[model samples]
Target: SHFIVGLTGGIGSGKTTVANLFAEQGIDLIDADIVAREVVEPGSEGLAAIVEHFGEHVLQSDGQLDRSALRECIFSQPKQRLWLNECLHPLIRKRMLELIKQSTSAYAVLVVPLLFENGLDSLVDRTLVVDISPELQIKRTQDRDGVDKGQIENIIRSQMPRQQRLDKTDDIIDNQGEIQEIEQTVFALHKQYLSLSKAVLS
Candidate 1:
């Protein structure tokens, strides 16, 4: 199996940008968010289960999962959120692990925004956190997502705290600067990961 790096950061922390840089280096990536969406895609067993539990209100008129409505439902009801997580987390984890096992790269990047929150650290060989200030997070998320500050704050509150995430990570990328600089940092890490993977294989 390839050496796996679990990449994580809080909402609006630019973790996706970092993951894309790693992908540019030809590293295979297993993005939990993508898998989450996949599991809930129309006609999937996961979506069927969701409809059974949450009812047709969670579906749009076109028969697809109504993501916005579902988000609102979960955010407003703690028990519903817990039930949904319990229902989907296993399916997501199963698919993610299967993808990781099939990867053919020197190392793989598993990007999970809720890595710590979901206790998924055991899935990877190391953890890399992208760090930024809360102010920047709020600003960037607002500019990109146009979501209310309160909603963004609620999301940040749900994830592992910044300090705790930092404490648990094996590496950190401070993403408070230019895109070029972030790419440079990723390139360096790419080299380091390549070396580490080679050493492990040897």
Candidate 2:
């Protein structure tokens, strides 16, 4: 198997940008959010199970899962969130490993937002934490998502804290800067990762 690197960040921490940098370097990136959505597509077994458990109220008029409705329900209720995770995480993990197995790059980057909270870090050989201050996280999230202060705080609080992520990481990329700086850092990291992978393989 290729060396697996798990990349994680708090909400609005520019994880997508970092992942894009890895992609540009020809690294295979398995994005959990994208995979999660795919697994729950209409008529899929995941959707069927979700509807069965959550009732049809979680669906929109077009018969697709209403993500907002589901988010609202889960965010307000920890048990509901846990139930949803129990239902979806395993399926997502199965599909993610399949994708990882198929990757043709020197290594793979698994971009999972909840990597720590869900213990998905065990799947990867190394963990890269994208660090940003909580103040910036809240501000960026508010500006980007139009969420109120309370909602942003709730979302931030719901995840593992920034310091905890830093504590658990094998590597840290501090991304609290301009886009160019972020790009430069990611570029450097990619080269380092490639070198590390080569050394391991040899």
Candidate 3:
């Protein structure tokens, strides 16, 4: 298997920004969010199952998943949310691994928001967590999404705690500062992973 780095962060952490840097370095990137959408595309089994379970209302007139509607649905209904996770998690994992297996880069970076929380870290060779303080996470998320402090706090509360995530990770990228500061750190990790992957191949 190719070396896989499981990259994750809390809601406000700069996971996407850091992942974009890796992509710019010609690294293969598989994002859980993208894979989630791909799995539920109009004609896919994932979408079919969702429609069967949640009904046609979850789909837009154009046949795409009404993401906002579905999000609202699951957010309010715990049983429905559990059902959805059970249905989608395996499908998402299968697709993500397939993409990783086919990757041509020296190694692949897999980005997932709830990587550790969902136990996805076991699937990757190395785990990279984008870290920031809870206060910073709250502030950044508030600024970027306009979410209220209480809601953001609930979200942070639901995920694996910051210290625990850091403990489990093989590497951490401090994203507490400005977004522009991540590029050099990303490049440094890129170089390390390249050599580490080569050593494995040799």
- Report the CA-based lDDT of candidate 1 relative to the real structure: 0.92
Candidate 1 local lDDT, 102-178, one digit each (tens): 99998999999989889999889889999998889999999999999999998888788899999999999999997
Q: Between prediction 1 and prediction 3, which has the larger lDDT?
A: 1
Q: Per-candidate RMSD vs. true structure?
A: 1.8, 2.1, 1.9
Tell me the TM-score of model 3.
0.91
Candidate 3 — number of clashing residue pairs? 0
Error of 1 at 199 (Å): 2.6
- The CA lDDT at 14 in model 1 is 93
Q: Rate the local accuracy (lDDT) of all candidates.
A: 0.92, 0.89, 0.91
Q: Write the per-residue lDDT of candidate 3 for residues 1-202, one digit (tens) a residue.
A: 3889999989988898898899898998999999988999989999999999888999999999999989988997989999999999999999998999899999999999999888888889999999999999999899999978999999999999899898888999998777778878899999999999998899
- For every model shown, the clashing-pair count is 0, 0, 0
State residue 61's C-alpha deviation in candidate 3, in Å: 2.0
- List the candidates ranked by TM-score, beginning with the highest: 1, 3, 2
TM-score of each: 0.91, 0.89, 0.91
